[model samples]
Target: MEDVNPRIAGHYDELAELWDDIVASPSRERLLWETFEGLLPDLEGKRVLDAGCGSGFYAARYVERGAEVTGIDLSADMLERAREQVPDAEFVQADLTQPLDFLDDDGIDVICCQHAFSHLEDLSVPLSEFARVLVDGGVLVVSTHNPVHDYVVVREGEYPTETMPGDMEATVETESATPVYDETERYDIVWNSGPDSNRATYYRRSIEGLFSPVLDAGFEIRDVVEPTPDEAFTRENPEIAAGFKQDAAKSVCLKAVR
Candidate 1:
């Protein structure tokens, strides 16, 4: 697999300082966390690997639940912030698309990779690595951009789309819309934090294409969740919440057992 970590790392380096505010948005973080938390196994005394652990937000939560947490990310700047946020947990700068040399086979009890897969060109390598590191019956929790949602967004052009950054190139085929749901494509996703905008490349895949790699990697799929905004989000942003519920899910969360 081609290494896209340097480019991805550069994109996140700029967003590291604003990461907290970016995810703190009710529409994204609140919905994601609520869904991911519900799928977590008993974490106490477990060995948890926080893959693509940006700023240790989720790692801290894992630690709070009494799990021994190790966080890995491509961005050194993000890892630095993660270390500060969760000093109790170990943080390493590593690429998800490569072998996890730092971990032993069947050593991890849980692997949490939240909103990170979109950056990768292929899922097989990482899923295989996850399977390698996770003990039998260990849990794997992942959250990523919902392909159905991306299709709707691109077809309707209801959401704002940005150009790929000049220095960062998309490795996969880039398409605004595909005739079939099975075609995987790369997209330029923009996130606005106040007046500043940060753009990154994301790969959109069909539901089947997304999960097939997991099954192929020897994981038994458990639960697949399309998270809806809760009452708290509805109370804060009624219009957005209504749109979220009425439209396709913005993200899909999956829980699988190794």
Candidate 2:
């Protein structure tokens, strides 16, 4: 567990320079924001924790909503960028797989983990820690790739290559867990930023494997949302739009209450 965080952190640290460009038109994240927006309680004067808050993209939104936000990330480089992106919020360099010692019991009202949740090799301790820190009835919102759409393959002859292109399709299957992240279940992501590209790895867990820990941590599942891109975004990117319409949206959101 200790080594996993550093390995993942190092990868993101390397991509820090090109992170924004690669995710410039992040439609997938837009869908997650839409799903979480309605379910989130009033943020005004509330304490919000953006767990695994990379680059402060979502943390800035919380700050705009009047929440006193704290954003934490494993990568120092990512934390540096997050601080710059959301100067008003507090940024901390921390590992998710370890105890969040900086926070006290029942200290937070809401915890949000965006695309970063899937990076955790184990969820038990973190979920328990979330339960410990969140006030009763507090919300925990997370977005991850849906296991149904885990059918992903590297392009032919792409192996032993540094990066993969952007013109790839993600398929869906229910039969077995797809090793998008390789044998150990870590996904090799080639993030493209203009002419430059960067690589990062992420874990892929089955639907049941992903949510069972939350339930075990005493969070009542409140909402399970499969969001589609908004009309404007969809029109701008028709290929991605078609996948959502075909029920192949690779991402999903879960809202739970402690």
Clashing pairs in 2: 181-186, 181-187
lDDT of 2 by residue, 138-254 (tens): 999888777555434322212221112344322222223434433225555554432222445566666778888899999999988877778897777787677567655666888
TM per candidate comes to: 0.87, 0.81
lDDT, each prediction: 0.81, 0.73
For model 2, where is the 10-residue window of minimal lDDT? 155-164
Global CA lDDT computed for model 1 = 0.81
Evaluate model 2: give its TM-score.
0.81
Q: Which pairs of residues have clashing backbones in candidate 1?
A: none
